[model samples]
Target: MEKSNQLFNQEQQIIHRLLLNAPFIPSVGLLTGQVGIALAFYTYYRHTECAVYGDFAGELLDNALESLDKSIDIAFSNGLTGIGWGIEYLILKGFVDGCGVEICENIDQKIMESDPRRISDLSLEQGLEGLIHYVLIHISASIKQNVRLPFDSLYLKDLYTVVKQACQEDIPDSFRSLAEIYMDFIEKQEPIDYPLHLFSFIDIVHLDTDKLTDYPLGIKDGLAGLLLKEITNE
Candidate 1:
């Protein structure tokens, strides 16, 4: 009986080590989602140069704030459910300290500097894509460093839960739809089955298969796919 207990203890120790060392244990979505939102905001700011789009730009900014508020509320509501609201608080605190205030002030100044009466004649969709590209580039290095391992369904589920919690606050219906689609895309992209309804906050969006190459997300997808396949095959 003592020998059997010793074997069980050894097995438990090994399992613990495996969980800690598992490359996919951490969620890459957190970093990617932040980059996506930042890019969306930057796109709105850069293309609102003419009066025609000025109101639209303002609306976009309002939407962003609403999105942020909703995300925070979600985090708070779920903070007690073991999803680590402390970390969310810390991340928000960092943004507030680092770029949050500065981004708002600078964006405002930039808008004011633009010609108030004329629109840039640029396609709004085109401009948004450009901003997303910039965001992808800016966040690429950091995300690559933090989530260097393959994707795992367990980690994706955890990440999705965290994001869902962050979406609990009031947000514009438009932003809410986009957020839902984003989560759905991530879910579909995962190589394994995750409990979808268990994390029901995200609404799946129709994605352009060709647009996957347009940003850092494309690279993330490729790398994650490769890693998951490699790990599972092993």
Candidate 2:
């Protein structure tokens, strides 16, 4: 826990530095959210199923560096202007270490600010990184893959429904105003996904932790109760 907190702080500092040096280019930085979602998924998967999550983080950090190289190559091939890859390795580190959602939303905001015509255009070629695309393609993927909302929190049910509806609905100004709704939904939904390993480390919440200690922890018993309660309410 101490180590994770330390790493989290370090990532925050790194992301701050990169944001300071970040360029004001358009459309190119959209991949930041996509990459963040991938990282979040992997993070949860590590805690739940993988024994080598730490090693995986190290390897992924290295891959983020390599991804910068690829981004540069992509930028050079296309006519996109600004930094070789507007998305930086430090930002990627922050995302993997638990800062991705915030960072991605920040980037998505940049996308919206850069192109105001996207809502009317509704064309990808027109550079529509507004709220809806951000929510559905980038943000939702991260929340669903990493946070395990449906698995944990009830408030998350309403939150996801709202965002999912915004993405699926044909609202005017979805790029700007509609996107705001999506952001609000995400903000409310975060608590559901947060404390990534909160329940997993407890016998009452996650029995696996107790199982490791050879204690008779009724992890499933509690989960069954919770599940029953949820079903009954439905």
Q: Of the candidates shown, which would achieve the greatest TM-score relative to the real structure?
A: 2
Would you list the clashing residue pairs of candidate 1? Answer: 50-118, 50-119, 51-118, 74-165, 180-203, 181-205
Residue 166, model 2: Cα distance from true site in angstroms: 11
For lDDT, the strongest prediction is: 2
State the lDDT of candidate 1 residue by residue for 34-146, as single tens digits: 22222222332333343432343234323434333222211111111111211222233232223322233332233223231232222212222112112222223224335
Clashes of each: 6, 1
**Whole-model Cα lDDT of every candidate shown, in order:** 0.29, 0.32
Overall local distance difference test of candidate 1: 0.29
What TM-score against the true fold does each predicted structure earn? Answer: 0.19, 0.27
Looking at model 1, report the run of 10 residues with the lowest lDDT sum. 74-83
Off by over 4 Å in 1: 1-34, 37-99, 120-234
- Superposed Cα deviation of residue 16, candidate 2 (Å): 35
